[model samples]
Target: MPKLNIFVGTMYGGALDVAEQVKPLFEQAGFDVTIFEQPMLEDLIQHKTDVALFCVSTTGSGDFPGNFVPFVRAFHEQGPALSELRYGLIALGDSSYGETFCGAGRALDALLEDHGATRLGERLEIDAMETFMADDEAVPWVEQWIDSQQLKAA
Candidate 1:
């Protein structure tokens, strides 16, 4: 019954919706959960959180939407400083954008990985242009991640 500190970042609300949905499920599973709206990468660097789940959307021209800029920069600049972090992530985008679909999600995952954060699960990519509910895929992905962590602990 340890706590899972969930860090969620969103743009245009889709990522937030996903985070909110996934959170209740985690809470129901006997895990104490603390949810935070991470607007910048600095939020990640500043907090000593366990099991961060980044939910982000790509903005114009492969950019992170306005709320996510600080987070992306912090990850890029000082991600390596977090030598003991563990993380999971969900990225939301439209393939229709062509030039830079899911770019923010990709960058965030890479930055976190470069810093020694163990990815608790696969990077869940949601292409809105292709599906109606990308977040639905996260259900199984997160359950598997949680189980994996338990096995590792034993």
Candidate 2:
């Protein structure tokens, strides 16, 4: 059975809410899902899941949320290659921030790629400046991604 892990880095809790919204959908697809808020690097290093989904909100100046600092630091210091991991990212940002919009997500995605993880699909960037919330886009994206995964499996 393939396992799925959700790790969220949030300021003001919006990304966490989005992650919670998607948990059941992954479960319904037969993935054993585990969710974490601002997970530690050690936890990620030892994760048993085959797939990882990140729901992260960029903070001021496009920085990672405060709670993500330790994890990011540890990963840069000595994280091993995640050669067997498959991952996806849902970046929550306000497009009004201009170039820095979704910076944290892009940084994390780059880190994951540097560590050799395979991205499951295009990184989903949700604009908080839009009329709709991030989950609006995320929900449908997850549905489609799941459908594609199922098709590939078949």
Top TM-score hit: 2
Q: Which residue pairs come into collision in candidate 1?
A: 40-70, 40-71, 41-70, 41-71
> The CA-based lDDT of model 1 is what?
0.72
| Structural RMSD, model 2 | 1.8
C-alpha RMSD values across all candidates: 2.7, 1.8
Per-residue lDDT over 105-151 for candidate 1, one digit per residue giving the tens place of the 0 to 100 score: 88878877777778876788888887788667777777776677662
Clashes of each: 4, 0
lDDT of candidate 2 over 10-99, digit per residue (tens): 989989989999988888888888988869987777879878899998999889998788889999999778998888899999999999
TM for candidate 2 is: 0.94
Weakest ten-residue segment in model 2 by summed lDDT: 145-154
Candidate 1 local Cα displacement, residue 74, angstroms:
3.4
Provide the overall lDDT of each model, using Cα atoms, as 2-decimal numbers.
Answer: 0.72, 0.87
